[model samples]
Target: MIEFKNVVKKYDNNITATNNISVKIKPGEFVYVVGPSGAGKSTFIKMMYREEAPTSGSIIVNEYALENIKSREIPFLRRELGIVFQDFKLLPRLTVFENIAYALQVIEKTPEEVEQRVSRVLDLVGLSAKRDNFPAELSGGEQQRVAIARAIANEPSILIADEPTGNLDPETAEGIMEILEQVNKQGTTVVMATHNSFIVNEYKHRVLEINGGKIIRDEEEGVYSNEDANA
Candidate 1:
């Protein structure tokens, strides 16, 4: 579970990215953070993974107090969560299988354990056959799938995606969504920040509509439209 109470993040340039934001995301729930550019969606998601620290507030993610978590302990905290980015950050030289296995290897998982976990996640993302291919050899969608596979290879309880489908075509984005849906179905809490209103309306979930660094609306099975988002 994730909880943020009275979270306020400010930069040195006198800009407030998030203002007194408080929200609770329960386990086994799929939540969408939708808003226009510079609406604090990225900053909000980045805070969850400890990429950015709040100026003052409490953020508890899977029992780790992000605001006070030590640098060394951040790795341990990350092990309990999976994160995917808009740009597929894969090792260009490594094969798809190796890319997924790298994360497990860093944590000192046994060779057998790494192989098993990597295989399972690659299968989950439907990229088992592309296991031997390098990132450069794969399509954009395939690379994203590889990224997702790598993120979830350790079976993190929480999966966080930031504009995961931002670079893919409509059909390819839908395919990625299906993979995420499957992951969520298996009990991973999914928190995604997206601008694709079609995806939001087509696959409804809890929506936290943010604007001007504040949550304007929180609705279960919320539908988003361009007009509604800007309203």
Candidate 2:
């Protein structure tokens, strides 16, 4: 579970990225953080993973107090999270299978255990056939799927996706969405920061609309924007 209480993040030059935002995300829930560019969406998501610590406030993610957690402990905290980025951040030299296996390699998993975990996640993302392909060899959707596979290979309790479909075509984006949906269905809490209105409206979930560093609206099963709902 994730909880934020009076979370305020301020940067240099008197800029506030998050302003007294307090929210709680329960286990097994899919939540969307929808907002305009520079609306503090990325900053908000980064805070959860401790990429950018809050200037002042409390952020508890899966029981780790991020505001004051030691640097060494950050790795432990991240182990409990799966992060998928818009740009597929895969090692170009590594094949799809190796890319996923790399994530599990850091842990105490044996070679057999690594292969099994990689195979399971690749199967989950429907990319088992492309296991030997390199990132450069696959299409955009395929690479994204590989990224998702890499992320979830360790079975993190929480999955955080930041603009996961930003670079894909409509059809490809939908395919990616299906994979994410499947992941969520299997009980991983998903928190996605996205600007894709079609995906948000099509796949209804709890929506947190943020702007000017504040959560303006929090609606269950909400649309991408208020105007879309009215229209």
Q: lDDT of all predictions, in order shown?
A: 0.94, 0.92
Q: Write the per-residue lDDT of candidate 1 for residues 47-117, one digit (tens) a residue.
A: 99999999999999999999999999999999999999999889898999999999999999999999999
**Ten-residue stretch with the least lDDT total in model 2:** 222-231
**Candidate 1: which pairs clash?**
none
| lDDT of candidate model 2 versus the reference | 0.92
Task: Extract clashing residue pairs from model 2.
Answer: none
Report the alpha-carbon TM-score of model 2 versus the true structure.
0.97
Q: Give the alpha carbon lDDT tens digit for every residue of 1-231 in model 2.
A: 999999999999789999999999999999999888878899999999999999988999999999999999999999999999999899999999998998899877899999899989988889989999989999999999999998999999999999999999999999999988999999999999988899999998999988889998999998776553333
- Against the hidden reference, what TM-scores do the models get? 0.98, 0.97
Best by TM-score: 1
Model 2's number of clashes is: 0
Please report, as a residue range, the 10-residue window in candidate 1 with the lowest summed lDDT: 222-231
| Predicted model with the maximum lDDT | 1
